[model samples]
Target: MDLFNPYNLQVITFIVLNGILAISIYITLATGQLSLGHAGFMSIGAYVASILTKQADVPLIFALLLGGLIAGVIALLIGAPTLKLHGLYLAIATLGFGEVVRVIFLNMEITNGALGITGLKSIGSTLYDWLKVTGLTGDSFGLSVLQMKAVLTLLFLLLLFGLVLFLTLRLHRSRIGRAFEAIKADETAAKAMGLPVAYYKMLAFIIGAVLAGFCGGLFAHITTTITPDDFNYHKVVEILSFAVIGGSEIVWGPLFGAFILTTLPEVLRVLAEYKMIMYGAIMVLVMAFRPHGLIGTDTFAKLFDRRRKQAARQAEEGM
Candidate 1:
């Protein structure tokens, strides 16, 4: 059915990008913190990476790392003062901070203000150029230059997502992750246990900020340009919705959610004028019927626990 068409390719690329964004929000939510401002951190990363690549000629990898680091630092600064606020208060503060960041960018000369930045380098084009320089063109790769570019870009982005997923899973099993769960379940009890609830919350926020920044850097390079508008409150809401709608209890949930939501619009294109209406209705249904998301943590936990018990019983019976 021509699944490899250019339009589908672009949608796949965006799915990877949005998956990263969803994971960012998931991290904070996992720690019981609602950060409605990750898009600001993302914008910071995008601009920093964009500037580094366009001006200083830095490598994309290094630019992305530095961008993430900068965003983490900013998160630390912002989180220190704001993380103490709980629930709705924290959400409002983060949302306000995002607005502030947008306003600042809109007035900054370095960012070209509201005019936005363009003419940035595309990772796919960059790889194609590199192949030409290295004399490893279609003859060696068994694919056309354009085809190679798409394959390489997809693989590169998937690798990035794999790393993120691995790290998130590892974090879920770590001491810090246990503390995050403890805090999320009962912040008061965690504090009574001398767990430093505030510190853990701040740490989660910073980690989420770093990941969002990294994703932002990649987004800039992939699209080859970006405007402040791209990382606005609407984008923040959309990214957060991914984690919420997907189920933040498990790392895979957000990735799955990102894939479904990202491709839904394209798949519904046949609906024409009714597509947006349908999309909103679907989200509303999900929220109303599946508040904990499509994937329920309790259900997954019970299923896995049952399997574990069954496996142990089988082993004992074999003996």
Candidate 2:
């Protein structure tokens, strides 16, 4: 019915943000790298975008893109040297980086020292005003102002998902993607085959960072306020959990995980404190049983192939 109500819209917006964060980690996971500090890159993007928009009156789109680019560049700088480490070592290094970022923000005068920057404009407010200017509000639609804003935000997030999905699929089919898979399968063998393993891994890490940064920019615009605490270690772990639980083998897996987990808190509101325990139990069960994730790459590929074959057979019968 009124799914675009403020409460529902808030939930939808969080889910969208979580989905983007999940995809960011998924990119690193695909390259067989476990980066646990995505929230740091996110903070970078959020602060940069917020500062630009609030102080300089930069357009939201430009601020977001610049934030993403800066995050990607930072990832390159961090990844080139650190990507050499594999497994737990890399995770630790990234985690440390995230902590360092949080600490820096905590003490920095530019970030207003822990209190964080506030009073930034919200996308919903901006959009609502713009629509009113264009005479698209009120009796034109049987919906509240919040509903219209929620619908617009949802549409925008969906558009973003499309772009991300397209680029991810394209990357998976390209030579670089294959290179990543090759290294993931066997680093030594991939190296033996003359592939630049380090470069490909760094590329994946940078891409993931850029995506997280972009999400952060959107987050700041939507929330209209951000604090250093928002991107702490716990947040990083949550993002990683979303990726692992969602099935980082494919791009859709993390998004699916983000949707389910982000909505679970609201769905289990009646349980209150117990909801967290229930969430943990579910995660434990999933890890114990579906170690590969709820939707592994093989399962999805086969399902799509089966559908394609079925469609082809039907077309031939028609002919």
TM-score of each: 0.92, 0.91
Global lDDT of each candidate: 0.88, 0.87
Model 2: per-residue Cα lDDT over 12-71, one tens digit each: 888987887887888888889999879999999999999999989988889999999999
Q: Which candidate ranks first by TM-score, i.e. highest?
A: 1
The TM-score, computed over Cα atoms with residue i paired to residue i, of candidate 1 is 0.92
Least accurate 10 contiguous residues by lDDT in model 2: 1-10
Local error of candidate 2 at 273, Å?
3.4
| Candidate 2 local Cα displacement, residue 162, angstroms | 1.5
